[model samples]
Target: MSKFKKDGKKNTPAVSTASLPDIVFMLLFFFMVTTVMREVDLKIKLSQPDATEIEKLEDRSLVDYVYIGEPTNTALYGTLPKIQLDDAFATVEDIQDYVIEKRADRPEAVHGAIIVSLKVDEETKMGIVTDVKQELREVQALKISYSTREKVNKKKF
Candidate 1:
């Protein structure tokens, strides 16, 4: 029994990190799958007009939005109707090019089906909207949709 005296240097089991990477990667994948990225930060104010007759699009992927309204920073942009493509302010003349480029970005198979949804603010004039339509027509992007909110029923309760 004296020969089996306790040794000062005793080996201790180390913690296993074999599944650490797997757990970390799983977390990363989960975040990647769950995260929803914002398309753009609107520089202009947008309040959709109320509509009595409006239909939702079947496929939203094929749709591109064109925001039309006065700039939120009226001091910088002045109080005038402006067109926003993606995130930047664009002019009426720039619409044709914007449409062309949008078409090129998408697959050719669905170019004809791609819809340009005009999100015009209620305060915005129809002239700007008409101009946008004209540009879309020039590019042959005929499939158009107007973004509007459902009219709330006014009930006296």
Candidate 2:
């Protein structure tokens, strides 16, 4: 006689749930470390000009942005467009200091590679842009870029 009988059905083990929380937490931590957030809360109303030729910067870490536009609160900041450096409203004379401080934050070797991008509103005066350029010259930060929108159809990306 046979010692044991063979059964047609076999039981399958349940799927493990222990590692599920670990994966969820790991994904949360990964996004927290790798994601980049908006640098500043823009107080100005900006409408960038259109451009046919535009080139995207390769490394965002090497570029700093300067924003110029009319204030969202016209009653407080008035109708004239204002210059924004970092989080605060600044004058044309403040560009040198701002550039110097920004350069100091980066590695010495990359200081020369840093580019200052001007995000100017279309309705803004040209004089302010000229002054900002002069200030950059004083700091020896010659690399510059003008931020503009691409001339594309609404449906076309």
Candidate 3:
């Protein structure tokens, strides 16, 4: 027997993918944990005004939203500004009922901490905002927030 053929076991070349499934599972779990689904679908168009002072909301669960703007489908709601609670257009008189319903959803322990965000369009007059504010006050929903775009500061090089 030749020297090369003395021990005739050939070395097999193969790539090990044993860790691939673990990597894929880790990535899937990462995305699943980080992703947040959109809670509300906005039917109306909102152009929020820019503001110098802005504060980020820490807990999203305790906040409620009220949309104020001219309806996207202007033929239906006309050109006038209207308030939207959840999915439906609401009048100033409807605010009390809506506040009551939202307040009821929260636990009594944190009733004072519930925040109502007023998302109003930039072009919308303050009259509509004032009306909503007044209505909110009537229901004693004192914690209110004005949603606005953060003012960008340009650094002079």
Best by TM-score: 3
Residue lDDT tens for model 3, 1-157: 4865745577665888999999999999999999987656776789999887889888888888999998899888788998889878889999999999988988899888989999999999999889999999999989888999987877759
Query: Candidate 2: worst 10 consecutive residues by lDDT?
Result: 1-10
Q: Give candidate 1's error at residue 84 in angstroms.
A: 0.4
Q: Native-vs-model 1 lDDT?
A: 0.89
The residue-by-residue lDDT of candidate 2 on 61-141, one tens digit each, is 999999999999999999898999889899988898999999999999998899999999999999888989999999999
Q: lDDT tens string, model 1, 1-157?
A: 8578766687666999999999999999999999867667888889999987999988877888899998999999998989999989999898888888888988899888999999988999899899899888888989999999999988749
Q: Deviation in angstroms for 144 in model 2? A: 0.5
Clashing pairs in 3: none
- Return model 2's CA RMSD, one decimal: 7.6
Candidate 3 worst ten-residue window by lDDT: 4-13
Question: Model 1, which residues run further than 4 Å from truth?
Answer: 1-37, 155-157
Q: Rank the candidates by TM-score, best first.
A: 3, 2, 1
> All candidates' lDDT scores?
0.89, 0.91, 0.88
Number of the top lDDT candidate = 2
TM-score of 1: 0.73
Candidate 2 residue pairs in backbone clash = none
- What would the TM-score be for candidate 3 when compared with the true structure? 0.76
